[model samples]
Target: MKKTQSCPPPVRRAALYIRVSTEEQAKKGYSIPAQREDLEEYARTNGYAVAGVFVDEGKSARKRYTARSAFMEMLEKVKAGEIDVILFIKLDRWFRNIADYYEVQKILDAHNVAWKTTQEHYDTETTNGRLYINIRLSVAQDESDRDSDRIKFVFQNKVSRGEAIFGNPPLGLKVEDKHIVPDPETAPLVRELFRHYESHRSISRAVREVGEQFGRILWLDGTRRMLANPLYKGVYRDNLTYCEPLIPPEEFDRVQELLKERSIRHNQTGRIYLFSGLLVCSECGRKMAGRYATTKRKAHNWEYHLYRCPTAMQYHRCPHRKEVNEEKLEAWLLEHIQEELNAYQMQWEASASAPVRPKVDKAAILRKLEKLKQLYIDDYITLEEYQTDYQKYRGKLDAEQPKPQRPDFDRLRTCLNAEFQTGYTAMSPIQRRDFWHSIIKEIRLNTENSPQILFRV
Candidate 1:
């Protein structure tokens, strides 16, 4: 029998992995060098050549395995059977995900490479050794999942209570130990903007003109669009969630009314509405009471009522005691309303992912997207959106490509659309909640004297 030369001195090519998430990086004992030294010394003492020590300093293991560059490359090597063992200070240091940790171990094991955590004193080659690592990874992963869930739970609780999280506080705030404190500087600007906007129904030039008064201001059209963001009023939202407005219906209706009238040329001070605030006295600025006078019309053969300034009749010296006839003003206002509403550019939807025909599993699509998200925190969707809509279109083209004997396009789309409609209807209650969370865009009420339509970023 061949002795097999003691299995070529156990091959002994080792890969060392060290990681410190954002929290661990802030702490002292969890230093990278200390872990690296301990891991490297353990490898050397165990007759293993340190092929390379993988150091993923300041990376989150809550993310998938491939996110850490060194660890990813190390996995590729492990799969190639280039390393005898993958070493870590402990199981969590290796991977906080059992799915990823054991998955990689299986790849290593299949390629005749063994994974050994020095501190744990286990090797994957034996069944008893595998059991120790199974428990270790499972516990580590459970803790990691729990920690992530706990953080998310805290954030959700804050949101449910209408608290701000992790952003520049709305125009009225300054950060105070993770809470929003009203800022004397920015608060007044916000108030004035809201006041003027509510009165005028103009957001086009208003945002730019108002922001220019400040030393530092956000002039981006997108940021300008946020002027009407309800989150500033303290709200939280998530995707497709629904919640009734906390504000009075009248106040909310008033804001909505303002958004409808905004236009690009609205800020020009050429015309003013005399009818505003029930027609004030030209001299005293007191609100004039409304009165109706019936008149006989000639050619059209009609009776008409007109509103006159009551204060004018009350005071004899008033020069502006004019009664504006209804027909003309009604026509004028209708024209204005028509013009404003018609002035809206067509709302073009960038193709709904170029139609994911036949394989109409929206759930699968969402799951795949989630997986992609786990692989990369930021996705091609955003990058594609930023780089070129054409790139997204091209991606849609790929997604839209027809496969042989796939489901009928129309039928699949119908089914999917029906499901989406059902979901949308169901989501109405939570829409308000989701709106606060996912939508970073501002929904400005067009402060122009137009109808109540909203402008969104």
Candidate 2:
């Protein structure tokens, strides 16, 4: 027989990964040098070449996977088949949760990469290794449970001492040192906002003028958010947990009552009133009532009934009474909207200075104004492009930055294009609903001529 040559053992190029959550600092013994030294020596002894170390330092393991940049990058390279093995000091050094550990293990296995640890030795490719890993994971889970109990104890002790653990101080309130201190720069403005809202009545009237957060003028939605914020009342609300009050909810409660008073004064409820008991019959003095309402699905709601007085339609009869179908009434209202738009267009045309088109790059403005920071990792654009766009966006973000108009009809047109691409015919239903409520008042009809729609002031 010919002499048989000895074959070399397979080379294992391993990447070391280490993670230490807040609780592990005490229990897991997750020191940077200690983990590195153990993993490095373990890789060398196992005939594996140590390539690189990925460390997720001081980050919570419970956090989303993407939150740990190095961990995520390690997975990417593993899936790319760059590393042949992953070595860690121990199983807990690898992961506290079974789901996360298994997910990463499967990815490494798919790429033909093996995973091992110094204390909990598991190869994943072998049944014995898998059994060892299962036991190690159970032990790791026990450690996690103990760590959680310790944290809860500490948190309860803190709460007992009246040491406030409010998530974030409200605007116009700064954490000077540790305790929340009133910010002189914006406190007065906040107080003024409440006063203005109280006196002005409608939130709409005070939205652009409310001197809140250092004279910060608000749009309708922003103003609503500010008003609804419980922090202004000095109460710290972290979801449902109510902590010590900061300002005093009573103050805001009074302001809310004032707002209701103003709303009633303006008679600006969505409900419409035309000839509301205004045209009383000369005969019996029973007030006339409107009983007709129409919906698009089934036109004349009044087909079943009429708008004649309940007394007139029923037992009590009065002269000068006429009945009309609510469905026909609603259709006539649509025609009035077209008429009003035509009249407004003619009036604008007669004006000497035509409303000039806005200079804002509507598409670019909206795209740049988006919450780019939130989409940082999800967006796959080049880093250079992201930086350039972010800088451009930040420069324009300053309130002092010169801008004549925020958005115009041109931007609305762009919005339409974007909406159509998602297999929708028009803007979102939300957009349509908001547009109608903001631009036009309720359509009015007394079962007579066309509808007369009053536009918003």
Candidate 3:
């Protein structure tokens, strides 16, 4: 018999992941092309076959992993068993969040795939290596957080000085030397829109007329937002003169009053919904709105109050199309209010008996304060950052240490002891609305039109 020739092992396929945030791209040798070159060279030296190159430009590793398109694509390749390994220039290039790293690591581990950084040594198989990787990740995350704080501080200072931040300016405005100025072309149209809306008092009509006259289609929501924006009146944040005014302050104020007066929620229909904002649709998790319908029965007109999912009624997206009658809902609650009260009372007693005091690591806060001071001294952080962090940590340490105190449940106990139905019946419509709002956090309406109450008490 001829001896069987043994087949050689398959070559390890490597997926190269390159990422660079806008800030990191300005640094030396941190660009996407530079990272790709290094990772490809590393893969070749390790005798691994190059599978594919994935690049996510202007994306922060500190951001959610799913937000990075290339990163997610690499994960899909790994899941499909098309890639045997993932290579990057450094662990920070892969992930700055330890939790996100572990979450993706689980998928990689299941596929018998591994990751390696060309410039950083991390071995997941060894305990020490894993701990080191975690420490490095934490350090990277701290650096990212500090960078974010510094950016926010700079932006805040700019806003205080009435300087525009990086982004497209809103409608009727243009950016000039990092300052917001009126766009001569769109400013006139915006002024016309506001004046037309003020006279007509109809967003739909204003949008249609403005789009027809200016040849620019204005979205209903965007138009509403523009009408309410303080920037149109040269006010941004707390700065009253952030930009050149497109609409006068008095005109802006008048438009705001008109908006409030024309709002559907503020319309006086002489009908009060006891569970106006309390009812939630179980299907879409949107608030159920109250509406009324009139029906003629035995030559007399009767008005029926009903609660239905607004998403289903307006957008037709929710599956729950059935309307729940307010009378039936009240009856159901009256029947079960005693039971809910009893359960809440028991919960209250248990919590009161053993109050839980907040646990704070005072030592950890002190250590952070010391580290912050050291960072400031070493010029790693600016004076503003040092002062902000110092005050924040000091406030955490000096604020009145929270003491456990039992909540007063006297009102709840009284409700539980009395006939809740009788008291609920005696209450007026407005009183009933306030009462339901006070006790019930939400009333979820299921597909079967069944009411499930979530009580705050």
| TM, every model | 0.44, 0.44, 0.56
| Alpha-carbon RMSD to native, per candidate | 23.8, 22.8, 14.3
Give the lDDT of residue 269 in candidate 2.
39
> Which residue runs of candidate 1 sit more than 4 Å off their true CA positions?
1-12, 25-28, 77-84, 145-172, 176-178, 187-213, 217-230, 237-457
- Model 2: CA > 4 A from native: 1-10, 26-29, 44-47, 64-66, 123-129, 153-162, 166-171, 174-186, 189-229, 237-457
Q: Which ten residues in a row have the lowest lDDT in candidate 3?
A: 258-267
Candidate ranking (lDDT, best to worst): 3, 2, 1
lDDT per residue, candidate 3, 1-36, as tens digits?
Answer: 999999989899999998988888996559877888
| Higher-ranked by TM-score: 1 or 3 | 3
Task: State residue 38's C-alpha deviation in candidate 1, in Å.
Answer: 0.9
Instruction: Rank candidates, TM-score, best first.
Output: 3, 2, 1
Shift in Å, residue 266, candidate 2: 25
Model 1 clash count equals 29
Give one digit per residue, the lDDT tens place, for model 2 in 1-457.
Answer: 9999999987878899888766566775787778888888888787887777899888776556678888898888887778887777766666666777787767776788777668754566679877877777777777767667556545544443334456465656665544455678777666666666654445775666654434565677766666767766654422212333334555577555444322222244344333232223334444445554444555534323234545556774544346544445433433354456556445544652445434555456546535453354455664456557766765554323233322233332443343433443264533433344433433343323233444432
**Local lDDT at 227 for model 2:** 70
